[model samples]
Target chain A: MNTLMRWIGIAVVIFIAAPLVIVVPMSFSTAASLQFPPPGYSWGYYQQFFSDPSWLRPAWNSIYIATMNTLLTMALVVPATFALVRHKFWGKSFANLMMMMPMAVPHIVMAVGYYSYFGELKLVHSKLGVILAHSCLSVPITFLVLSANLKGFDLTLERAARSLGATPGQVFRHITLPILKPGLAISALFAFIQSFDETVVAIFISGRDAETLPRKMFDSIREEADPVIAVISTLLFAVVFAGLIAPSLIKGLRRMAGGTPSK
Target chain B: MSAYLRLAGVNKTFGNFTALGHIDLEVEKGEFVTFLGPSGSGKTTTLMVIAGFEKATRGEITVADQSLAHLAPQERNIGIVFQNYALFPHKTAAENVYFPLQMRKVGKKEGMKKAAEMLDLVGLKGFAHRLPKELSGGQQQRVALARALVFEPDLLLLDEPLGALDKNLREQMQIEIKRIQKRLGVTTIFVTHDQTEAMSMSDRIVVFSNGAIEQAAAPLDIYHRPATRFVADFIGESNLLEATITDAATGKAHSPVLGEVTCGAEGLPPLTDGQAVSLLIRPEHLKLSREPKEGRQNAQMVIETIVNYGDNAVVIGHAGDQQIRVRVPGADVVILKEGDSCHFSWTADAVFVLDK
Candidate 1:
């Protein structure tokens, strides 16, 4: 049973990791199209991906839109989470349901709704249209992450601060904000990823001027299987992998530095 | 001199549920008072009302003759050490202590220096740079104490601050807190359900039951002369016998278990003839003997159980239908056994009468 379980675990890991294995090497492949077991390996596609303005513009646009979506989502979600978690008022349950409504509805349905609504508003093909739509889609996940953090927060800390002569504003600034810094950062990261990876809404409202990276990738894959897509995918995976490991890496470096000074 | 901290007819209600019912209390400056009661009693609610965390719905609270009604909690200048310590996780011990000074607009350099000094006062001298999570529970308690006292606020309210500590540490923190409060001469109110903690620390204890003050007096007075049956039963171990005052003039009462009993005691409320009352005999005051001792009121009971506590033991037995507890020296317990008929004796001075 133990050996069988071990085999199953390894098989599951390999299955989950199959995409990275296929994508990373194919990114450097000398093949003409998106093909595995390539004829040869080179950095040719990586260079092309960096040099092409069409690919580059969408990459920058995705970054800009994701950043804006994160900011807007946090601005809406923070106060909403605090209210929903901490207070009692009329229609609170209704308000809570509305906050989580976008997560329940399908993204394709939302994309179709925004495509026409934004078109009538003369916002189609503009960066603001994509940003606004992504912000709405980002709200549920942002609120979920933030509200969980807010619930676990010891409210006695605020009362203690007040007793220590800090005003409500000062308590939030000095105690609540600093203590919740990590949770806020994680939730904002989730909002950014949601926007950056969102293809449906981006394809709908982001017609040409505001075409995002995911939409561009979708268009390129349909028209001509660009190996540059694999290069972009590999670069994104590296960026995310670096982000995931950065905290522990910093901690390890600090421990080494601290040990050296002590010795 | 007027009381430094006063709650006059303070009442708090959450919709229909009354939390604090007409509380009127006064504490002199530099006195350490404790609010002692079980959970859901008005002890912690009264503390919150005084700290401005919970507003008193009906009555006014004043500190130093200044009304606290118009002031927010920040403007009231009170310090609180919550039950959980409530230390800011992100801030180092020194930074946590410096926070109040920072809110007062003190420069960071001077504030941090003061914070370090305060930490030293709490016996956490070199722990200034460490975050709260790095410290042990007792050390975290000390840091919390330092943080609360760093600003020298008008009042310090501790809400069961040592309830989370282990037995040894809880006792140690109790002594430490009392010492710090004395050294600083801050008017402090500590809340706890632990009767021993209340007895060992407070200059005065206010006993609460069911949203009202049962009795507020010195610790020994509260133990020996509780004003009501609840206070008598709550403060310490007691054998509260149902009795009626037969003769108010001679201080005599009748108990079913002890037959006729002499009940005159100092500080007892005035009794009347035929007045229904409770006769309170403390467990420690009752002496257990093999035979009825001369010149002492005695009752025969069948010993049902003996709870030994190394130094002392409680002998629980029954006289008729009444369960009587007699605390005897642990060494004396060997002479007695369960199911043996023993005579428990008490003098009239040890029995106090409470009106039913």
Candidate 2:
């Protein structure tokens, strides 16, 4: 049974990796149109991706908007998650359901809603509209991650600190915040990635002035099938690969350092 | 005279459940008091009230004539070592100890120096650099003690800090905690459900049951003369007998198991004739013999079971419908076995009468 399970796991990995393998080599292809097994290969698409202002503007817009979305999402979610996880009050279940409601609705449905909503508010093509819309989408995952961490935290540490002459603010600064740093970091990263990779809603509302990278890529794929999309996909894959492997590499190094005999 | 710490008419209720009921206590400076009780007995609730974490529903608490009703826990200047030893996991032992001093705005050099000294006082001289996870259970307990005591707060509260250790380590930490508490002359309240720990470490034991104080007296007084039937059964091994008083002046009581009995009258209240009462006798106070001894109260019982420990054995038997227990030296077990008819005797002073 174990051998069979191991073979199944290997097959699943191959199934997920097959599409990504195609994208990496296709990014270097010199072909102009959408062709899988390209006739030639070069770094021409990479040069075009880096130099063209049309692509560069959307890339910058996505970075700026994602960063703002992360900040706003964390600011709103942290205290709300603490309250929802730690205290009991009336209507708490309803409030929790409301926070997760955006995630329940399909993004295509939200795209239509935001199109009408932002057009009425005259925020249809602005950066602020994209940020506000993305923050709503980011709240559920951020709250879920943060509330799980807050629940696992041992509350006796705060009590001990308070008894040791730490005021409420000092307790939060010294004990609660430091202990929750890693969870906060991961939750903020999730919010940033959620906004940066969002395409459907960005396509409906980001119109022309605040065009996000995903929205621009979607349009480019439909109109001309720009090879630069493959280049961008490869770059994003490399970045995620580095992010995934860095923590374990650092942990292995620490283990080796800790195992050495100390004077 | 005003006491150092006073809790007057302190009552706490959570919704419909009463957690504490009109608790009034006064503690002299430098005295070690143990709140001994089973779970849900308001001992910890009282501690939280004193520590300013739980607000009393009605009354007030004062330490040194200063009302604590409006003060937050951080302003109470009380140190507490929790049952789980809530040491900061991210900080070293020295840093954990220095936290209170840092909060008080002490300079880093002086605070760290004092922290090291406190660590040394708790016998953790070379262990100042290790985190709490790296330390053993007993070592973590010592670091917690050091951190709680480093600032020399006005009061110290320990809530079953030794519950996590094994037998030998628990005993060792008990002595160590008592030594540190005495050396600092800090007014301390230790809460524990273990009666043996209370008996061995406390200057006075306050027994709690059902959110009320059952008895508050010195350790030996609480042991030899429990005020209530709950105290008698909760503190130690006891054989409680239902009896009726025959004479108030002569302290005479009649029980079905032992026909006529004389009880100690030093602290017992006045009793009326034909009043129902409970007679308590400690297990070790009863003497077991093959025959009735001369000049002592004796009763005949059929031995049902004998549990052997290394140094002593408990002999459980029945006299009529009442169960009796007698402690005997291990050497006497060779000549006795289960199912033997034995005579158990005690002096008048050993029997305490409680007018339930």
Candidate 3:
């Protein structure tokens, strides 16, 4: 059947990605040179990563900045996307066009613009400056996902809410927010990844104090050039894997908790 | 209020095309007024205006003598039912019914109590916890009706609420709606293009044509004495006869081929002698006989064709130069056959002079 062939194609893709998982243990190399199926698994590199102030400091900074950037981006993106979806007005197309601009242009191109803009504003090297750059890069993804979720929504609920005597704000808080749960989770997850995995924008905007995890990983590759990069990538791959699997698991649990859809 | 809702000089223009114009209607506190017309006749537009979902370009609307122009749809205290039912797919039948009460800040216990009463009123007592999709078309419509009535709105506007049901269910829902609307006695404005639905349920019907009220009257009057040719043709099956005013000799006008007709319509408008005008005659009103009547002067025509629809018969024939159809009660064994001669006669008052 056609369905079986599609599943076979998916299996082929997973089969292709199988050997790449070997890269995870390569960071344990006891020797100075990088080798796959690491020569001897040792706790030395991980011990170096945990105890040494040098290795731990930038890693902490990168995690904090990316987390903060994701939060800030969601704050702006959620309301902007809601307004775009709910109302009809002049220049609506223009607003949608503007929101999509940063995603369509390459991140490196925007990174150059951000670098010069921040430099002239004297904000370069600050944590806030790097956060601003990351927020900009993640916003398009968040807005697009949230907006698509909102457009197909039945607007009569809002009308019914208003007629019921809820103020517009109460309707938005209670009804709109409840219905938007799935989309919110999806958008927040995507936006977090976009900021956390950003390298090009971080390289251009970050100073020594504002370096993110991906930027630090890039610097580590340049200096030592070993399989430690693979360890970090595998760690990130785990996070992405968690995000991808969580939706289905949560949905399954919800389905089990509830019965089938009633007539 | 004497009249629960009233509209005057209403005009609506979507871009350059006028969707509704110069509409006037008054629905009494407990009366059921229907907007009946074909598609694009502004029935839905008029409903939207009354619901406060649309603004009129120039008009006045008063619900219970309160001006509705500045009020929002929620503030208007009106209930709406759409063609699709618009039930919350996520909410159970009981929960959907209770939505409006919750909006008004009613306590949950009281809201649920009232919602259950409404669900029972609609005869969906045991299926209260089921979602909309779980119900049949008729049950879904009952849910929609329950949701609308639970709020006890000042006016209930139904936009073709029974349109999606099959014929049998649609007929059943018609009676159900009529019973419910009468029981509630809430002012109702029901809109539809289905003339049978309008005739069966409406206290008064407003026939719409091209953004204007063609005729607004009781169902029988609108059918028997339509003010326009459009109304006669639209509301029921009518045979339009292009007849000349051959003589106003008896101090009354005689419409040709329509037997010998006399109207107390003294002025006769400007239709002079030999001027062709349309005469509206309902098909069912034509009395067809095989034998010539003793004292009745009737127009004789040969039966051209007979369509035998079970329970009724449509006898198409040529009367003079005009083709006409006569409907008689004969879905059973029809005595009339093609190529046979038949005599047709109608009462003096049955012929309606169309304003053409």
Chain A TM-score of each candidate structure, as shown:
0.96, 0.94, 0.86
Per-residue lDDT for A55-163 in model 3, tens only? 5666787778878988998899988887798788899999989888888999899989988899999889888988888888888899989988998778876765665
Please say which candidate is ahead in TM-score: 1 or 3: 1
Error of 1 at A199 (Å): 0.9
Q: Estimate each model's TM-score.
A: 0.97, 0.94, 0.85
User: Model 3 over residues B251-279: C-alpha lDDT tens digits?
Assistant: 23455565556543532455566656677
Per-residue lDDT of candidate 1, residues B49-154 (tens digit): 8888898999999999999999999999999999999999988889999999999999999999999999999999988888888889999999999999999999
Task: Return the lDDT, model 2, position A188.
Answer: 97
Q: Which window of 10 residues has the lowest lDDT sum in candidate 3 chain B?
A: B262-271
lDDT of candidate 1 over A120-190, digit per residue (tens)? 99998999999999999999999999999999999999999998888899899998999899999999999
Q: Score the docking of each candidate (DockQ).
A: 0.65, 0.56, 0.34
Docking class of 1: medium
Clashing pairs in 1: none
Best of the two (1, 2) by DockQ: 1
| lDDT-best of 2 and 3 | 2
Clashing pairs in 3: A164-B103, A263-B133, A263-B134
